[model samples]
Target: MSGRLQHKVAIVTGSGSGIGLESSLLFASEGANVVLADVNLPSAQKGADLIKDRYPTVKGIAVKCDVGKEEDVKAVVDLAVREFGRLDVMFNNAGIMHPEDDNALNTEDRIWDLTMRINVKGVWWGSKYAVLAMRQNPTDEAKGLHVGGSIINTASFVAVVGSATPQIAYTASKGAVLTMSRELAMVHAREGIRVNSLCPGPLKTPLLMDFLNTDEKKQRRLVHLPMGRFGEAIEQAKAALFLASDESSYVTGTDFMVDGGLTNAYVTSIGEPTLPPPSSLI
Candidate 1:
C-alpha cells in the first residue's frame, strides 16, 4: 500500500535526537524524503543513514543547522528543495531549555536570550523560509501535490497553562511559538499553506528527562499529569505525521495538543495504570 506521505519531502530540525529524530525516521518510513537539520552533524547524519538503510526507497540528507541563525535555517530549506525537488513539510523542532532557566528573578539575561534565540527565533526563521519555498511548489496533478506545505512548530503544554516549576524563559518562548504559528497560519491559509503548533506535554525525551533528573523532580510534574506517565517521542511523532500529511490539510492555525491530559488536570490519581505485559520496567 502507498504511504500517507508518498512523494512528499520534509525537513526536520534538531534531528540528532529526541522528537526531531523520531519524526524524521517516521516521515521517511511514510515515503517522504527527509532533510535532517541539526547542529550536531554526526547525529543528524546518523538519522540520515538510518533512513537510507531502513527505507531504501526514500532519500535522507543531514544539514548542520543552528536554527537560531536565519541563514542556517534558510540553508536547510534551500537544500531540501534543491535535492528533493520540493518542500512539503517543515518540522521546526529545534529548541533549547537552558539549565539556568528558572524564575524571572533567578534567571540571567544571557540565559533568557539564549533560550529565546533557539526556541523562539528558530521557529520564526524556519516558518518564514519554509513559506517562501512552499509558495514556489509547482502543482503536480499526478503526484497529488500542490503549491503549499505544512509547518509544525514545536510548542509545549506549558504554553497554554502556568507551571509552578518555573523555567519562565522557556514558558515565554513557547507562548511566542503558539502565537507566531497562529498568525502565520492566518496569513497563508488562502495560499494552501498550513501552519500549526504541536504542543506536546511532559515528554520522556532528553530535553525533559535531563531537566527532571531527580526522582523528586520527576514526581512533582508527574502528580499533575492525569495520564501519570511522561509521553514518548513516538507519540509526538505520530501527531506530527498527521499534521504533515494531507489528513490535516484543513487543520491550520490550531494548537494541536498531544499532551496526555496535563492541561486538563485538577487533582491527581492515587496510582499509575498497570503497564502492559513485557514492559521493561517490569
Candidate 2:
C-alpha cells in the first residue's frame, strides 16, 4: 500500500512546479530517492526542501538543469547515480508552450525551435542518458536476462488529436515524444527498460493557466472537456507514481491519458464543479 517505490532512485525534470513538482513529492512519499531538476534552481530547491522537511528519512536533491541542453540533462542523470548509487526512474517532464507558438503560419522559427528543443530534443537527451545509466545497473527483476528500468515522458493529448486551438509547435513536439517513446520502449524492451508517455489534458498547471488571458480564452479550452473541469496536478502525479513503481512493470510504450475525459468526448457536457471557474485563467 505504501513505499511502492522503496529503494528506487529517480530524476524528475521540471520539478519547479506543476505536474513535476507534484510527482516529485509523490515519488518521495512512495519511497523513491528523487532528484528534482529544473531550470530554476530556487524552485527546484524549494520542492526538494519541502520533501526533505516532511519526510526526513527520504533522500532528495535539487539540481539546476535546463532540459533543452543535453549536458544539463545528462548532469541530472549523473547526479542521481552519484548520490543515490543507482538510477531506476527517469521522468522527462519539462516543456514549454510560448505565446508565439500559435498556428503554423503565425508561429515563428524561433518559437518552433525553442519548443522542439525543449520538448522533443530534451526528451531525447533525457531518454538517451537514462538508458545509458539504467543499462549499467539493472536492479529491477528481469524476465529474460535484462535488468530494466522505467522512463516516463510527459506528453499531451494534443499529440493524438488535432487541436483547433493551434499550438502547432507544442503539439508537434508532443507528437514526437509519443512516437519516440514507443520506439524507445520497443528497442529497450529486450534490455528491460520500459518507456512510456504521460499524456495530460488541460490541467490547471501554471504552464496552461498562465497563458489564458480572458474568460473566453479559458472557456474555449473548457468547452472541449467532457468533464467540464480542469485536472488537478495530484491526479497526474498518481499516474506517474504508478508508472514509476514496479506495479506498471508490464506496462510500456503506452500513452497514459490523465485528461478529465477531454479526449473521449465528442460533445462534452458540463459536469460537477471541482475547481472554481477561473475569472482569469492566467
Candidate 3:
C-alpha cells in the first residue's frame, strides 16, 4: 500500500529538534522525500539521518538554512525542486523567543530585531520562495494534473491571546505571521496554492523548557492552561501533517490551534476552585 504523501517532496525549516524535527520524520515515514533545513547544520543533519535510518526507502536531505535570509530560503526551495523533481509542501517553522526579556519595555532592540527576523520575516521569505517554486509546476486537474502546493507557517496561541509572562517580541512576530498567512492565502489562492498558519500552544519543547525551568514558573504557566499539562511535540507534528497532507486540502488562510483547549477555555481549572490543586497549577 502506498502512503498518503507518496512521492511528494517537502521542506521543513527549523527541523533540528522539537516540532520541526518530529514533523520531518513523520513526513518521511508517510513516504515524502524531506529537506530538513535549520540554522544548526549538525542538528539538521541528525534529523535527516534519523529519517534515512528509520525509513530506508525514503529520501532525506539536510540543508543549512537561515529562513530569515532570502538567499538561504531560495536555496532550500531550489534544492528541494532540484533533488525531488518538485516541491509539494513548505513548513516555515523556524522561530525564536527570549524568555529572559518578558516585559515589552525591558526587551532590548536586538532581541526584537532577532525575533522578528527569524519568526516573522523568516515565514515571509519561506512563503515567497515556496510560491515561486509552486508556480513552476502549474498543473490543471482538468488536464489530468495536480500541480499546486501547501505552505504551513508556525504561529503561537500568544498571537491570539496575550501571555501572562509576556515575551513581547515573540508575540508581536507571531501576530505578523498570523496575518501574513491570511494575506498570502488570498494572494496565491488563484495559483492553486494553500497557505495556513499553525498556532501551537505551550508545548514540551526546548524553548518552553528554557523558559519554564523552575517549579514556580512551570506552575504559573499551568494555571493558564486548561489541560494543566504541556503538549507533546508529536501532537504539533500531527497537526503539521494534516495541514501538509491532502487531509486539509480545502483548509487554508486560517490558524489551526493545537492548543489543548487553552485558547477556548475561559476558566483554567476544572475542579475545586476554592483550593489550588497543586503548586504546579500556580
Candidate 4:
C-alpha cells in the first residue's frame, strides 16, 4: 500500500539527532522525500545516509542550515524545492538550552539572546520561507488534489506551566512559539496551509540527558511527572508525523501536548504533605 506521504517532499531542521532525526527517518520511510537540515553537517549527512540506506528507492538529502539565520533558512527551503520540485512540509525543530544558566537571574545576556534567536526567531524564519514556498504551489482544488502544505513548530510543556527549576529564557521563547503558531495558523487558514505546535514534556534526548544526568536530579524530576519516565524521541516523532501528514488535516492552530500527563496533574509540596488536625486539638 502507498504511505500517507507518498511522493511528498519535506524539510526537517535540527535533524541530526533526537526528535528531528527520528522524524526525518519516519517521513522518508512513509515515502516522503526528506531534506535533513542541521547546523552539524556531518550529523545531518549521517541521518540522510541512514534513511537512504534503508530505503534505497526513496530520496533523502542533507543540507547544513542554521535556522536562526534568515539566509540559511531561505537556502534550506530553496534547496528542498530545487531538488525535490516542491515543498510539502517544514518542521522547525532546531533549539538550544544552556546548562550553566538554568535560572532567569543567573542567565547571561548572551545565553538569553542565543536561546531566543534559535528557539523563537528560527521558527518565524522557517514559517516565512515555508509559507512562501507553499504559496508557489497551485491551490489544492486547482491542482486536482488537496496539496497545500503543513508547518510544525517544536514547543515544550514548560511553555504551558512553570518548571520547578527555571530555564527562563528557553521557556519564554517556546511560549512565544506556541502563540506564533496559533497566529500564523489563523492568518493562513484561507490559503489552505496549516500551522500547529507540538509540545513535548521531557524527552530522553541528549539535551535532556545532559541536564538530568545524576540520580538525584532524575528522582527530583520524576516526582513532578506523573508518568515517572522520560519520553523517547520516536514518540515525539510519531506526534510530528500526525501533524505533518493529512491525519491532522482539519487540526491547526492548536497545541499537541505529548507530556505523559505531567501538565494535567499536580504534585504535592516537595517536602511536606497536608494533614488533618488532631481530635484533641479540635
Candidate 5:
C-alpha cells in the first residue's frame, strides 16, 4: 500500500507457496515488478498470474529454478535482468526442512547432503548470482533506480537458538545462511549492496499445521512461544518487505528476526546506493 518498492524489480525464490508466495504478492502490491522463481514451474506461474490479475500495472514473470543448481540460479537472475533491465532485490528464500533430517545419529548422510544442497548451498548460489547482477545494475536517477540492490536470505529461529525437536540438517543450514549473509554484507558494502538473513519463528502454515496435527504436538512447540500463537506467513512477509525496500537501506548483515519474541539473542552487524546503500553496523 505504501508503494515502498515502487518501480523496483525483485526476484523471490521458493515463491510457489508459503511465505515466499505471500512476499511475492506483497511486493507486487507495493509496485514492484516481481519474478517468481521455484522448482515447481506451475506454482511459480500461478503466483505470476495472480500478480497479473490483481496488479496489472507491474510486471510478473515465472521462472523454474532449483536453487541447488548453480546454472538454474544464474539463469533466473539473468532472466530478471534481461526482462526488467535491472535487479533491485534478490530474496534467496527457497529452502527445505527435509522430513528425513533429524537427530545426528538417525539422520542419514544422504539426507544431510540433500538438505545442505538445497538449503545452505542454494542460498550461497543465489547470493553469488545476485551480487553479480546487482553490481551491473543500471543507474536511472529519474526512476530512482541505482547500481546496488538488497539481498535477503531466509533463515530460521533455530539458526540462532537450539531446538530440542532437532531437525539438525535444517538448523545447521540456517546457521550457515545467517553467517554467510553477514560476511557477504561486509564484502560488498562499498559496492552498494546490502545482504541480510530473515529468521521466521514457528508458523501455522499448512505444512506445519499438518505436521502439528494433534493438540499435544502443537502445544509442545507453543509453550515456548510467549505470544501463545503460531506466526502467520504475512508477518514474515512484512519483515521481508522491510528488508527489500529502501526503508532498510542502512540495515544489513544482521539477523532480521520475525520470531515473535521466541528468541532474544541476535547477531549484530552492513552498504551505499542512490537510496543510501547499507552501512555496516559494526
Candidate 6:
C-alpha cells in the first residue's frame, strides 16, 4: 500500500478542509507531490504545511484558487507542472450545499447560479486543464510511468437517488457532475485517462455539520444512513486513493458510491437494534 502513487503529482481543490484536505494528506503519504488549492489562502497554506512537515520527502504547495474560475484552475494545473514536472491526478473535490439551496420555488436565482458555478462549472474547469496537462505528459513506460492519469470528481448520492428534503440546486448540479464525468471518461478512455465520479453520502464534514445545528436535525438526516453514523473524511479519502492509484486502471465512467449503505437502504434501521440479541448478550 505504501507508495501507491509514488512519483505522481496531484492537485486537490478545496484542500483547506473536509474530504479535500484529508485526501491531500493521504495522497502525500502514498508518495505523490500535492498542490492544495483553495479559495482560502491561509487555510490552503496550512494544509500544505502540514503535509510538508509530516511527509518531508514529498513536495506540497498551497495555491489560492477559486475552482469556479477557469483562470484559477488553469493556474493550479500549471503550478503542479512547474513545481513537479508532471500531473497524474486531478481531484475535483470542491463543492457547496448552502442553506439557501432548498426547493426550486424557495431557492433564489443567485443561490442556484452560485451552486451550479462552483459544483458543476468548477469540475468542468478542473477537468479541462488537467486533461491538457496529462496529455502533454503522457506516461513514459521506460521510466516506469503509466500511459495516462486519473480524474476523480466528488459527486454525491443525491445525484443518483431522489430526496424529499430537497436541495434542488445542489442535487441538480451533482447530476450534471455525474453525467459530465461519464462523457469525459468516454472521451478520454482511448487516450489512456480514466475518469470516475466518487459519490459520498452523509459525511461529518464541516459542510454538513454547519447546517445541522440541533440533535433533532442530525437525527433526521441520520435516519436514512444505515450505519447510524455519518462517514468520516478519511474513509472517503481511501476510496479516492484507489481511484487515483493504478489499482483502478480499468475503472472509468462509473459512479463509485462510498455511502455506508445509505443509498441502498429503503427504510434504514430504527433508533435501536432491529433484531433480537444474541445468546451471549442474554
lDDT against the true structure, each candidate: 0.93, 0.89, 0.88, 0.88, 0.89, 0.91
lDDT of 3 by residue, 132-211 (tens): 88888745455333677899999999999877766889999999999999999999988879999999989889988898
The sequence of per-residue lDDT tens digits that candidate 4 reaches over residues 1-282 is 257787778999999999999999999988899999999999999999998799877888999998889999999999998987788899999998778647867888888899899999999999999999988864445333354689999999988996766688888899999999999999999887899999998888998888777888767667777776789999999999999888888999999999888898787334455575787577
Model 1 poorest 10 in a row by lDDT = 267-276
Clashing pairs in 5: 270-280, 271-277, 271-278, 271-279, 272-277, 273-277
Which digits, one per residue and each the tens of the lDDT, describe model 5 over residues 182-260?
A: 9999999998899999999989887567656688877767767767688999999999999999899899898988987
Per-candidate TM equals 0.95, 0.92, 0.92, 0.92, 0.91, 0.94
Which 10-residue window in model 3 sums to the lowest lDDT? 137-146
The residue ranges of model 1 lying beyond 4 angstroms of the native Cα positions read: 272-282
Error of 5 at 230 (Å): 0.8
lDDT of 6 at 99: 81
Regarding lDDT, does 2 or 4 come out ahead? Answer: 2
Clashing pairs in 6: none
Q: Cα RMSD to native, each candidate?
A: 5.8, 6.0, 3.9, 3.3, 10.0, 3.7
| Model 5 score (lDDT) | 0.89
lDDT of 1 by residue, 66-182 (tens): 998999999999999999789999999999987788998999999999999999999999999999999999889998899999999999999999665879999999999999999
In candidate 4, stretches whose alpha carbon ends up further than 4 angstroms from where it belongs are: 138-147, 268-282
1-282: candidate 6 lDDT, tens digit per residue: 289998899999999999999999999999999999999989999989999899999988999999888899999999899888889999999999888778879999999999999999999999999899988885667555765799999999989996546689999999999999999999999988899999998889899887666788787778888888999999999999999998998899999999999888876766786665696567
Residue pairs with backbone overlap in model 1? none
Measured on C-alpha atoms, candidate 1 has an lDDT of: 0.93
TM-score of 5: 0.91
Model 3 ranges with Cα > 4 A deviation: 138-145, 270-282
